[model samples]
Target: MPDNREARAAARTDMIMRTTLALAQETGYAKLSIEAVAARAGVGKHTIYRRWPSKGLLFLDSLLSLNEPALDYPDTGDVMADLRRQIYAAVDLLTGPQWGPLYQALVGEAQHDPAVAAGLGERFIRPQTDKTVARLRAAQEQGQVAPGFDLDLAMSILSGPLYFRFLISQEPLTRDYVDRVLDALFAGMGPRGPADAPASA
Candidate 1:
């Protein structure tokens, strides 16, 4: 496979995406334009349009390319440890300031753009969230979690506090904060043993 042409095209695409992310980081999405992206990317106007028909499509693709690979569920012979690792991996990505603004803009845009909303749900949310639920289910099968624990509800509990910290309180997202949330969640949902017996008379 000595196709020089394909390799060059791929490199150009990568350059465009890198340049687009840099611009989007410097300026809000509302100010993004094809011309600006072309200038930043060092590509011709026709080159940009040849691939993406609209700014929304280009922006969506650019944002998606920035995501890290989904964290695979680890089987460390201990459910609690595995879950803590998985949840924290997600939290780390969300708290990174470079990508946080992009996520915020995407969420805000999803409120009005059905196309972007659907794309987000399919491409990013489903893949990552499904892994989380699967990990929880594996733990449940091993009796490490309560049999009646609602998987969806449980994930929400694990993530809800972190989201509130970042999106509501606007506080610094720190490991200590994540640890506290995980502790409270585990207290509520982790395994339960037999209740203590009544005291002797």
Candidate 2:
């Protein structure tokens, strides 16, 4: 357990992150200010600065903290099944009430603000991409993915439709759609062979 001072500091930091996400969702990140977060979080501005150099970092930290817990992938040995499960769980959370507003606000603001864009990519997008790539490579070692497949393209195939639906199409994201995405991706990347033959390396 944390000592009194450490416990208080942790509590204060959580408050700041919670407040930043809420205010940013309501006011939008482009309009959110450190002063407002401090005011809402009930902490001095200096307390925020002590950890994050600016409001963008503070906002990014809040997003990273929120995403970290949900990002863990439980490998069930069947790579495709695991990927589908993880993607659906993520889509559910991103589309759900608790975090969707902040997600949309951050993404909307990132388009107009380069710092926010970089922070979002660095903190959120890149980690997810890298993690997926690592899993794809592992799947290849197990002969689940063709050796010729590009890991980057694999990441895109997994995420492209999900984001397109989330940010553009605004269609309902279903588990069936998630399964289809992976199935199509695998078919394209799978080995070339006769219809009844096994895939070759």
Candidate 3:
């Protein structure tokens, strides 16, 4: 059990993270200021500075903390099904009510800041991609997926449509959209079988 002091510290951190997200949502990150976040969080400026060196770092932490740990992926011995579950989780993050705008802001920031770009790639994007890659490799080994399929390429193929929808198309992402993407990618790359049909026309 955490001591009272420790629990209070944890609560303060959570407050800060939530406040930062709300602030960013209301006014863009470009206009965010440490003084404002500290005032909103009800903490001193030094307290915020003690935890993160810059606003970008603080935003990164807030984004990364939103993820329910990666080990939450289910094995289920069916790699395609497992991948679908994971992809659905991604869809939830991209299109879900709380985190979607945060993701959008980070992507936009990454366009200008090389450091933010690198951090977002390493902290946010790659971990998610790596999970899919591992699932693909496991599926291949289990003989559920083609042995010759390229994991990186396959991951890209699986993700390309989702990113296109989320970033490029500027439309609301839906469960139906996710289903179509999974169906299309898996039909093309998954092992040939009677269970498979021509992907959604």
How do all models score by TM-score? 0.83, 0.80, 0.79
- Tell me the whole-model lDDT of each prediction, alpha carbons only: 0.79, 0.82, 0.80
Per-residue lDDT of model 1, residues 27-133, tens digit only: 88888788998987788989988997767667777888766556787989787788778767766777677778887777667778888888777878778788878
Model 1, residue pairs in steric clash: none
Candidate 3, 137-190: lDDT as tens digits: 888888878768888998888888888889989877777877787788777777
lDDT for model 3:
0.80
Tens digits of per-residue lDDT, candidate 2, 91-157, equal: 8888887676678777876887688899889878888788788877888888788777898988987
Question: Best-fitting candidate, measured by TM-score?
Answer: 1
How many clashes in each structure?
A: 0, 0, 0
Worst 10 residues of 1 by lDDT: 191-200
Error of 1 at 78 (Å): 2.3
Q: Residue 81 of candidate 2: its Cα lDDT?
A: 79
Instruction: Supply the TM-score for candidate 3.
Output: 0.79
